[model samples]
Target: MSPVIQEPAGIFITLEGGEGSGKTTQARRLCDWLTAQGRHVLHTREPGGTLLAERLRSLLLDRSAETIAPETEAWLILAARRQHVDHVIKPALQQGMIVVCDRFSDSTMAYQGYGRGLDLRTLRTMNKWATGKLAPHLTLLFDVPVRLGLSRRRGQRSSQNRLDREATQFHEKVRAGFQTLAKQEPRRMVVLDASLPLESVQRNVTTVITRWLNARRRQPRQR
Candidate 1:
């Protein structure tokens, strides 16, 4: 797909990890901090953002819903992502808003590609097509052991989803997939030890993001 809009002036940041990796919390914190710095921030999440995309998110996560085929799951997520990018992310970025998304294409690659045995290359192409090649300026991958992450999820009384019910091996594959991806794109991705206390993890995240923003500010602007 062709570019939906010219390169955006704003920064795009995404958080990725297995269940209970504190991505949502960190995303909120980052957005709050960015807003405090007088930046226009748009905090959003994958598989859901716009109305249509949210509906798809429901279908994707509903445990009572019919067993969706693996390919069907991939298409549904891509469809929601297409809507999300077109309706929310792209417009926000064009308006010079820092978009802090909870999960994005990387989740799909980790879940369906690694967890469900899908083709990573094909999924990458589909993700590019869905989002019109809009990639994040920074991605924070919260790394944690599969058992620990799953245990945390089990302890959470609310927000349990179908994905959370997957076998341990599935989550292990997903975790490994994220590790591989972070290694492949070290510049754009920062792996954080998520097993640390909330304050410690947040401190690391804030430090890394603050340094990145400062560095970007020091760079000469393009014509």
Candidate 2:
């Protein structure tokens, strides 16, 4: 099946990974690099792009006094996604900007579905409805060992979220889930060895994106 395009002229790229995989840093670097090349770029993150969505992000991430059920977590994430799509992502794409989102639908599939034992099929369907079938034009998945990623997160004690505190087994499941996804959609999702030095990863990211844009420029535009 063909992918959905929020806007024909815009490029939507997402950076995804488990905790402390360095996707956030890479995302910012991508935006900066694109801007230097004269591309109008919009950097945003899932669960926190719009005002309403940001509120939901806080609710989802903060150490809650109550346990958040897996289903409930999925519902809230999709709700935030709906707001993000309508208020932030779609509009930026409409203006013909490169939208650099830090996380997107795949996070839900990996974290809640695989890690928390929710059904992947159900989450995929829900994600489709929530985002109006919007999918990233390209997805860069930063991959690292769960122990390594969690160890990195542990070093950042001040910013630890509830997800960060999950058992190592949970993170391993999420990592495996992302791997399965990358293998399933090899064309769209590029997996990077995130354990590499920061400079090397950034170089690889820039090279990959430049190549993708050049290839797209050669292809006939789709209506």
Candidate 3:
């Protein structure tokens, strides 16, 4: 595959992890922190970010009477992604706004490809087509033990979704898949030990993001 061409006009940051990895919380906090610094940041999430995409997200996550096949699931997510990239992500980037997304392409690779036993290469091709090869400038993968993560979800007050109800082994596969991706692309993907306390994880996240943004600002533009 060709190198991921991150949007040159703006920075795109994505957060990925298994269930209850605290990525959602961290995403919100990061966005708020960035906003306080007067950065033009747009906070969004995959399988969401637009009306159509949110509808698809509901269908994808809701525990329905009808069982969705792996291929069907992959198709729905890709469709949502297409909507998100075209309607939400690209426009923000073109305006030179920092976009902080809760989840993105890596989630599909982990959940649909590895967790659902689909073909990773096929998914990649589809994703490339769907997003026109747009990829994140940075991806933070908050990894936690499968059992602990699942337990955290169960302890949550909110209703559990289909993914939240997945079996232990399934979630294990997803976490492992995320770790593998981080290893494969260390420059773009940073792995965080989410098992740490909330403040510790949040501090690590903000510190890393601040340093990354500073580093990018110092680099000379490519011709």
Clashing pairs in 1: none
Clashes of 2: 0
- Candidate 3 error regions (>4 Å): 1-8, 220-223
lDDT, model 1: 0.92
- RMSD of every candidate to native, in Å, equals 2.7, 2.9, 3.2
lDDT of 1 by residue, 1-223 (tens): 8867457888899999999898988888888888998989999998899999999999999999999898999999999999999999989988989999999999999999988999999999999999999899989999999888888888886878999999999999999999999999998899999999989999999999988888888872521
Q: State the displacement of the C-alpha of residue 72, model 3, in Å, after optimal TM-score superposition.
A: 0.3
TM-score of decoy 3:
0.94
Put down candidate 2 lDDT per residue, 62-132, tens digits, no spaces. Answer: 98648998999999999999999988888888889999999999999999988998988989999999999
Instruction: Record all residue pairs in model 3 with backbone atoms less than 3 Å apart, i.e. clashing.
Output: none
lDDT of 3 by residue, 117-142 (tens): 99999999999998889999899999
Q: Which TM-score value belongs to model 2?
A: 0.95
TM-scores of the candidates are: 0.95, 0.95, 0.94
Runs of candidate 1 exceeding 4 Å displacement: 1-5, 220-223
lDDT of each: 0.92, 0.91, 0.91
